[model samples]
Target: MIGRRILLAAGVLFGAAAFAQAQIDNGLPGPQPLDAGSMILNRTLFEGIMDRNSKVRSASAKPMPAGGYLSYRASSKVRQKVTREYLARAEKAYGKPIAEGLRKTLGAIDFVATWRRLATRDGLRTGDLGDSVTAYWAVNWLVANGKENSAPGQMQALRRQLGPLMASNPGVRRMSEAARQEVAESLMLDTVVLAIGADTAVQKNDPAVLAKLRTTTNDRFKQAFGIDLTTVTLTNRGLAKR
Candidate 1:
């Protein structure tokens, strides 16, 4: 079910730098203060924590223990680099006008609203970022149509449009090719998880399709986070609760 997928993905992100921000953004409401060790506990939110852990364990150098959210001081540096690199690349590839638009517009708001707003805006309708703008349109479409669980093809279409669009931006491309790689990686994971959940919910309520996808849907929980699906809970039950 969509609910299960959201839980699993959310669980997978439990301890990353953006996890707390995501939690609040997802409507959890209110911040829960974290003690120092609590940050370490969040390492599972990230996959490379193990690599950090191995280094900490074997080397005489004492790096912070892994497995916490943004607690690794390194992530702060990494995130800044990403934003700066992307901005610089975007500025160069897109030119001053479009780059400023992206920074002032796209960067200013949350993802969902940004996409939807772009789709409706006249000024954003044109430019080097057109493909990215269209990609967001597609995202908003899939989400609004409730085909969130449709298939990979939907996401593929968005990728197809946005990938080249992103590439076309010299500023964005100036950063190593890895910048696009990172965005694609994170987006793919996020989309697949959410789509699976939406698709599950749709199929779940359908008698015939439900039977076929029930097992597949059940396993999506683990597929998303590697954790038992039953253990995690969602406050919103998959959809934004009314």
Candidate 2:
């Protein structure tokens, strides 16, 4: 009976893998010629990191208020170690720059996961919107730049994979429409930033294109979010110089 049960479980696992591969072969959506193998490997690595973080967080939970702060610190250390190991493996598999982008992208995924957990464990608060916006920005930057140059179809695959993860998190559904709009606008701004950043050669040769992108992004942000991204950019640059 045990042998039969083991065989049944193996078959289920095989079937699931086959179904995922079939999805890749069919090219569900967004970009073409997907690197399914790399996607699978990266997804596995990403999931492992998230799983380790969750486990560490659960293990470090304390009953006392003072112990709670200590537990948070301990969990953070474990998360950092897990992130480093996975990121290093990613860098080895993919080049440094691409891996750096993936680090931000996957980190965004983890952030969303954590937010979702927090919202569920405790009721949603206004502060959650800020965290969600930040995650959306990082994801947008990686996805937009990735679609244009680095690992084109792979980002789409990653995004697709992330959908189910997000859907499973109840907090996402509870977010207000206005907060969601802020997240969307943040993503749009980041997309523009990446497009401008990626065109190093063009920027060096023309210089005008960079100005054009800046103007365009500024206008778009103003129209969409009613905020001045140009001023924000300039202010950030000024601070960096100092």
Candidate 3:
């Protein structure tokens, strides 16, 4: 179930592939917040301490162990580098910040740390840095290709289209409210990204380009999680303005 959620979360942002051919793997590696010593302790517990200590609201909180603190700092530096590298690559590929809004959104999210905490709490592995990077690039792709302008409308159209799919899937309906919401949002985001890519292809009258974009998007999602969006029933026409 958690696996499904992760895949859905990832798939939601898959349409960011409309940018140039650069891959997310070209970005820096995922953060390694746990050193050899810290690995001996429960990751959740250690993550809790790190989270509490790192926050401004928790200024009065006790500090993490020296090793944990050092690991956090190291991981943070690497994460920032990954973001910088991704943006630089996008800038070079496109003449400007494509998807500037999306890039800003991604920058605002400390996804590495957030995913680390979430995965640790859920007993999942935490090393899929490429997934997060792909998501960023996907958005960057959208921004670069001018798809960001239509993203909100596309997102809403997708939600309306997905309503029936969500209702029909008992497994989705059975999820906890928070999990369900997350899945819904992720799915919508993925749909929006795909719609933008498809729209770009249509505008350019390039079916081959569309095929490549779809292939790349699916490949990235598959790399992160085994799910493939091509098989999903959601349609690009769903993104059309009503």
lDDT of 1 by residue, 1-242 (tens): 11112232332332221322222123211111112112112324322433333334232222222112111121334334444554455455445654454344324433333332323232222122223323333432343333333232233333332333334444454533343333422232233323333444453375544333333433432343243323322111111111
Scanning candidate 3 in windows of ten residues, the lowest lDDT window is 63-72
The better candidate by TM-score, 2 or 3, is 3
What is each predicted model's overall lDDT from 0 to 1?
0.31, 0.31, 0.34
Q: Give stretches of model 1 more than 4 Å off.
A: 1-140, 148-164, 203-242
Candidate 2's clash total is: 0
Q: What is the lDDT of candidate 2?
A: 0.31
**Top model number, lDDT:** 3
Residues 1-242, candidate 3: write the lDDT tens digits. 01111222333233243332223223212122212112113334423433432342222222222121111122444445545555554555553545453365455444444444322332222332222222332332343233323222222223233233333444533444333223322322333334434444545667566456556655654344333344332122221111
Worst 10 residues of 1 by lDDT: 233-242
Superposition-based RMSD of candidate 2 using all C-alpha atoms, in angstroms:
20.8
Each prediction's RMSD to truth: 19.2, 20.8, 17.6
lDDT of 2 by residue, 1-242 (tens): 00000111233333222322222233212110112122123434444534443334232232112111111111444345445654565456445764466465444445323333322222222223232332332232222222222122222222233333333434544434443333333332233223323333132455554344345434433343333433221111110011
